[model samples]
Target: MYEVVLVDDDVIVTQFLKRYIPWEEHGFKVVASFQDSHSALEYLLENTYDVLVTDIGMPKLNGIELIEQLKKSKSNSYHIILSCHDEFRYAQQAFKLEVFDYILKETMEETNIIALLGRLKEKLDQEQFTRNQHLKVTKFLERNNMTLKSKFIEKLMKEQNITKDGWWKEQEELLKLNFSDKYFTPILCFIDRYQEAINHYENETSLQFSINNLLEEIFTAKDQQDVQIFFTQGKFLILLPMKYNTREKTKHQIEAILKELHETIYAGFEVSITSVIGELNVKEQSLLESMRILLKNKEQRFYYKYNSIQNFYPISYTRDSIFQDYVEISQTIKELILKDKKDQILECISQQLKQIREKKYSPDSIKDWAIKLIIDIKLSLHALNHFERQSVVITIADQVIQYVETFEHLEYVLADICEKFLEQIRSTNLTTRNEDILKAQKFVQTHIGAKISLKDVAAHLHLNSSYFSRMYKKETGEGFVEYVTKTKMTKAIELLEHSTKSIEQIAFELGFENKSYFSKTFKKYFGMTPGDYKYKTKEKMN
Candidate 1:
């Protein structure tokens, strides 16, 4: 509702206007009515009103004086002058003050006043709508400007060489960048626990937006000209103008700002960041080099404790291979996995990871060790008839390990893989208890004298060849080929111990085409050639 005030130095006129105008019906509220212009002006000066109706021929301060005083005070109220026939000259003065309309006291009508109020309400509504639209446009332009600045900075960081040509100058002016030849400090920020943070944010853009907003709020001080640029891979760069002349002071300043930033982000977003502040340098080229240094030193973050702030330092690659202990680590983990000691396996993994972390091994080396270890464990367990050969974890181990950015995250990923391994182990154990698996094993033992195939056994059981093969592996944890090979080897041992058959005859009977191939298979399975095994047996007998 538009509030209104009536100021006439006649009690009858003020009473009639207040009681008969139907102010509420016309969306106007007569908040004040005065028989003295001075008191009305005092009330108007202290309070707020949207419309003013006042008599011009009063003593001391008339309606003209009140309107003039309001105009001088920059009041936006719409004014309607109440005048008599002799006060026509006062209407001219009211017009100069931009009064909405004039009303003659002798000929005032309720319909005319209501109509004027309606028009005034429309004007106010239109102005409000225009103001809202202007505000929205302003906000949109500001947001767009920030986006353009971020994109420009991102491009500048990626460019190998920056030329100070016409286009560069144009962009500098457009983006309000003052880094022509001024020395500035570059700092790199890494979002720690990025994999988990990404899951929290649901995507990269949201996480970037949130961090950028926080940076803006923290760096918007008048004394600071620090520009934050979001680089790829959960990394952001800060270009701080040289406020302090010496390198030490500038470094100290950058460190303090980063500490605040780290605390602020963690407090607001529940996320931590690792910051690497580069040395002070001059110009865009220097900045480009500085950025490269910051990014190069980002590798050092892999070994950093979570949410650490550090001066830039190059990463030193170790000459010792992380894989030198590969055999020991792999064998230990494989044994734990086979034993289905999930907690022990995880603890063993944690101990080894801690050792790797303490060594400060390069990220690539750690990843290489992890990938090879996971694959080797899968293969070895499969050979032991404890896991499937083509498991999902085996297929994606390289990709998963290579993408791990931090040792903490790497540990989580390794634990997940181990959990899957235990799942496979438990699955295999459950399958060995399956009645169908036992029946399949019986079929294999009963047909041990013949060369058996997965399809042949699958057909005898009236199951799909492909489906049976899959179910068999999923249930028993070993492929049909391995099961058959082990069964045949056990049978070969029985025949050699009990019957007087030559190794070649036993090999032919067990479906080996050549004695050498059979002996090689026997050596691989039993860790000795058939002749060595038989000779050892005969010597034991003597």
Candidate 2:
């Protein structure tokens, strides 16, 4: 809808126009009205309106003077004049000032005014459509230009050699770059905490667009042809030309710009950036080399503190592999899981991730280690009969490595995996303990003829001794050692009653060391030694 403002000395006329114009039906809105032209001009100066309707004969300032002032300031409002027959000359002056139309107050009618507004709405609508089309075309061209530049830069980076004379000149002209023989410094940027940043946006494309807009605005503000920026392959490349004669001075210039860029991006968007600033005096022919060097050093971002801009340094990697202690680490994790040490499990994962970060291993090597570790953990669960293999979990384990862009992110992924694994272990451990207890009872009965130990029972169950001890005591109302002792005593009684085995022989068969210890234990449970019980039973039978 087009906004309309009215200015007329006649209060009645202004009120009537505002109240009964049916402006919405005609695609117009009367936003403000003033009985004096001066007040209307003041409002117009601060706000934008599409149409102005004012009376020519007013007090402090007339409609003609108001239009004249607005014209001087290049306001784009369409002006309509309100005049009586005595003010015909004023209307003439309004036409000279390029007003849209004139209305005589003596002959003005509601229908005529509404019809006029309809035409004005048509004109405004057409102009707005044209402006929108032009804007679309401009954006399309800009996007195409940026795409071409990005492709050209990518091609240069891929080719083994980049010559100054061959395809360089053609691309320079075609892409409208001025780096023929100029000295430039290259800078590369990686979005830190990219996973978090991506989640903050609607999608990846929106995030890219926002960053591009911010970069363009900042670089374009410098208004220098020497500065160029490109977004390609999940990174930003900035080419800063050597404007100063000395490298030190150029360095200072680059520093100032980077400081601004980093601070603004982080402050405005809550997004941290890691930048690698290159040499200040790289020639056009060495541009790709400088860029490649910067790109290679981008791996340094894996260890970079968030929101930092650092000068170029040689890339380094630790010679030792993270998998050297895989056996020890994996075993420790399994023990902790069975022990139900949740905090220790997470801390253990954190420690390994910290080591990997400190070593600054190649990204691929780190990811490989992470994948192997997680998969081995799942396999350990399966071996313990605590986990059933799920294709979904395996798929996650395989694809998770690709998303490990930083040490922090990698740690988060590994930590989440550990937590979920702990959940599975906890849930399954409850049911597993019931089955394990039953199996343990059966094993003890089968092995009751010999001496049974808690350690032996735990080993049979493939569980840690201390963990098994606690679980056995909790599941049953007796300690494992106590249970073993009771089982032996009960068997001794059965032998005494059912068979004519000698006391010494029965003691020996029940895994007792001798008759004295057997008798002592038997007296404690039945209030008599084995000989007394046997004699009493025989007396009762006779």
Candidate 3:
């Protein structure tokens, strides 16, 4: 609700206005009423009001003087003037002060005052709505600006050569990026256990956003200049500028910043990041090369722990004799898979990767070998009819190949593929057993009241009775005759419990010709005659 304050030098007028104004009915509440303009000015100094009503003619301070003071203090209240005099000077002064309304005290009416208050309320409401709309538009533009900046940084990084040309200068001005520095250094920052972080956040975009925000805060706090941070393929790339005069000093400063970044991440998010710094002599022409070098240094991360900072060094490769036994390794992997030796298959893949890494083969050669091994395993599964369609295997193989950048990454992919293949084989074995056992179980369950024999079932299945009997026993742990007799006894017990059938009728319903034989079998199974069992059960119920 809007608040209003009334000021008048006449006590009677002030009292009447306070008691009879119906301010609340017009969307306002009279919070204060004063017979002294001085006290009213003092109240206005400390409190805020949505509307102010005061008499124009006063001793020390008039309505015009009070509004002028309010305007000087930047109070945004609507003012209405009340006076007994209809002098031109008073109305002119009120008009000059931007008074919302001028009324003569002798002609004042409650209805007119209420109508004016209503218009003031509408104006306030419109202003509030406009302010809210402006705030929303501002926030939207800020978010869009950030998005566009990120895209521009991504594009700049991907470009092969980035020079300070005309177009580059235009972009620099538009995006507010400062890239005219003499020397540039690239730092590659990778979140440790990135997949676990994703799982914890349950959303990759939110995690990335949080990390970016932290980086931006750190950089801004340190007053780092000519720096750009962007994310690509789950890693952060920061381009830091260095001055020629303080190259060593700048390098040490960057190292300190990286250390702080690592500690802050661990403290805040319980995660560590590994940062690799590239050469500090990178110029505009060599930005792409610097990026490549920094990324290559990220490969060395496999050898170190989290929160390590290191420079790039060439990996020394020595050929191993195991590469000559590629065919034997392939055959061994196939044999292990077929034998369902899960642990041995993983061990073989690990050993092969170790040999390949030691051989220091080119990335292309390693990828080729890995692809071939994946294909051979897939073909073996197909030959055994373990998988119905080849598309699934091909898709997995393509993923492995697509992600094979480093030797360590290749090993991870191959291990994952081996695990998937093991799962497929296990599922296939389970499905085969279910298909056979479920069919037989369904047949027996559906024909429970029929006088079915082993030969009859075998004929229906197109198998010899002897073989079918042995298979059923092996699968269900019961001989064919034993199974059929057990099924009939189970049905006979249900009839005795829930049905009012006579013993002879129950026996006939269960495919038992002789009632005496059925009772004997029931006694053997339950250690009691059917009549005695039923009578005891009824007694317990009573």
Candidate 1 has its poorest 10 consecutive residues by lDDT at 383-392
The lDDT values for all models are 0.77, 0.77, 0.73
Give all TM-scores, in the order shown.
Answer: 0.58, 0.76, 0.47
Candidate order, TM-score descending: 2, 1, 3
In TM-score terms, candidate 1 sits at: 0.58
Top TM-score model: 2
lDDT digits (tens) for residues 23-82 of candidate 3: 777778889999888999999889888888899889988788889999998557789899
Residue-wise lDDT of candidate 2 within 392-432, one digit each (tens)? 34448768767666777787887788778767655554366
Q: Which consecutive 10 residues in model 2 have the weakest lDDT in total? A: 383-392
Q: Candidate 1: list runs displaced more than 4 Å.
A: 1-159, 226-233, 281-285, 358-360, 375-402, 423-519, 522-542
**CA lDDT for candidate 1:** 0.77
Give the local distance difference test score of model 3: 0.73
